[model samples]
Target: CSNGGLEGANNGKITVPAGVTSFTITTPTVDDDLKEDTEAYSISVGGVDATGTILDNEEDIEVSSVTSDTQTEGTSLVHTVTLSGEAEAAKEYDFTFNNGTVEDEDIGTLQFSNGVTYDASTGKITVPAGVTSFTITTPTVDDDLKEDTEAYSISVGGVD
Candidate 1:
C-alpha cells in the first residue's frame, strides 16, 4: 500500500490533519520491469473546505521513467538521437528506427550514412552506452514523383 499507491478518485483518498495545510504523496522513480516506464494523471480535490482547501490550479500526478516524441516523415531526416538516463558503466543498448506504417510497410528510399545502418536480421541498432546522443544521417530523396511524406518512428524499448 505504501509503494505503488494510487491517489485517484474511487482508488484512494488523501487526507491531512485539521492543523495541516498540505500533504505529500510518494511516487516510484524507476522500475526493474521494462513495462513500467511512466504514467500521469490529473487530480481534483473536492470536499468541504473545513479540512483543507485544494488549489484552484490544475494538479497532475506524473509517474514516468522514459518518454518519446513524434518524428515527422521527410525525404531527409537527420536525427540526433539521445537515449534516456545516465549509465554508470560502458555498455550497449539495442534499439530500432521503424519506418512507415505496419499495414503499408514503407521504409522509404532515403539512405543512411556513417555508423547508422539498418539491420533487417536483428531489426535494431547497437548503440554504445554512456553516449547520450548520436547523429543519424539520411540522404534526401526526390519527392516530386512520390505521393506524400510517409510516416516513421524510433524506439529504445528493445534495449535490455
Candidate 2:
C-alpha cells in the first residue's frame, strides 16, 4: 500500500460507530519537489478494496526574461531566461527567433550558455538538470546601408 509516493501506516484498526455503515479513512502522503506523473494505490477494509490517486503538486516550468537591453549594431542583444523552479530532470523547451523588421542576414550566430544547447533540426533548447537560469545572445550585423532601426524577438513555445 505504500507504492506511488504514498506513505503512512499501512494497516490499522478503525472502530466504526454503532449502526454506522460508512466511515472515512485518511491517508497521509509525502511531499516532494520532483515533477512526476499521477500515482495510484489501493486500500482494503473489511474485505473491500478502494482505489486512490496521488495528484502531483509540483509546479510547471516557467520562462521569463531576466534581461532584454537594446544593443547597437555590431553588438549583441543579451536575453536571460529563468525558470520558476529548479529542474528535477533535463527538460527541453521549444523557442523561435523572429526578425521583425530586420532581414535574415542582419542576424548573426546565436549563442547559448549555462549548459544549454540549441537543436537546429528540432528548433528546441535543451536545458540540463539543476540549471535554473541561462542566457541567449544574438549578435547584429553592422552594415554600411543606412536604414531605420530594426526590431527582433525571441519567444518560448512548448516545453517538454
Candidate 3:
C-alpha cells in the first residue's frame, strides 16, 4: 500500500481484509503544463510489483501570447511572440495578420530571427529548439487618408 514513489501521487497505506481477493488504487493526474514523455512507476506489495505508466497530455508547444505596445504610424509594429514551455524540438506555427481598421497594404513583410522571414505570401514561423520567444516585425504605412487610430492584430494559428 504505497504510492509507487511517484511525485504527482500520494503515499498511502491500505488494509486488506481477510479473504479479500482484490482492491483498487487511484492514481491522480497532474497538470504540469509541460510536454513530457510517458513516465512509469511501480507499486510493490510483499515482494511483488506492478507497473503503471502516465501518459503526457500536455501540448508540445504551449499557448503563445503577443506582447507589444501601441506603435506610431510609419514605424514597424513589432509583435513579440512568446511560448510558455521549453521545447525539445523546433516548433512551427502559422500566423495571419488580421486587419481591424487598417488595410492589407498597411502590413509589410514579416521578419524573424535566425534568417527566418515571411510575408503576406506565407503564413508560417518556426521557433528553433531551446528558443522560447521571437519577434516579428512589419512596417505600418502612414497613409495620407486621416482617420482614427488604426488597429490590427497578428493571429497565431495551429502548431506543427
Against the reference, the lDDT scores of all candidates come to 0.42, 0.77, 0.67
TM-scores for all candidates: the values are 0.36, 0.64, 0.54
Q: Lowest summed-lDDT stretch of 10 residues in model 3?
A: 1-10
Query: In model 1, what lDDT does residue 58 have?
Result: 21
- Which segments of model 2 are wrong by more than 4 Å? 1-30, 34-56, 158-160
Clashing pairs in 3: none
User: Better model by lDDT, 1 or 3?
Assistant: 3
Ranking by TM-score: 2, 3, 1
User: Candidate 1 lDDT (Cα, whole model)?
Assistant: 0.42
Off by over 4 Å in 1: 1-75, 86-90, 101-119, 158-160
Give one digit per residue, the lDDT tens place, for model 3 in 54-126: 9888666754687755888789877777788866566666777667788777767667865444544666666
lDDT (10s digit) by residue, model 1, range 1-160: 1323324424656544455555544443443322221345444555533232222222221111223333443344555554554333333344565655422333344343334445558765543334445555543444334455455555544421
- What value does the lDDT take at residue 103 in candidate 2? 90
lDDT of 3 at 125: 63
The per-prediction tally of clashing pairs is 2, 0, 0
Error of 2 at 71 (Å): 0.9
lDDT of 2 by residue, 1-160 (tens): 3223333444365444456666566678889887656789997777999999998798876775455669888898888888877766788888887778989888888999988898989988898888889888998999998888998777764321
Better of 2 and 3 by lDDT: 2
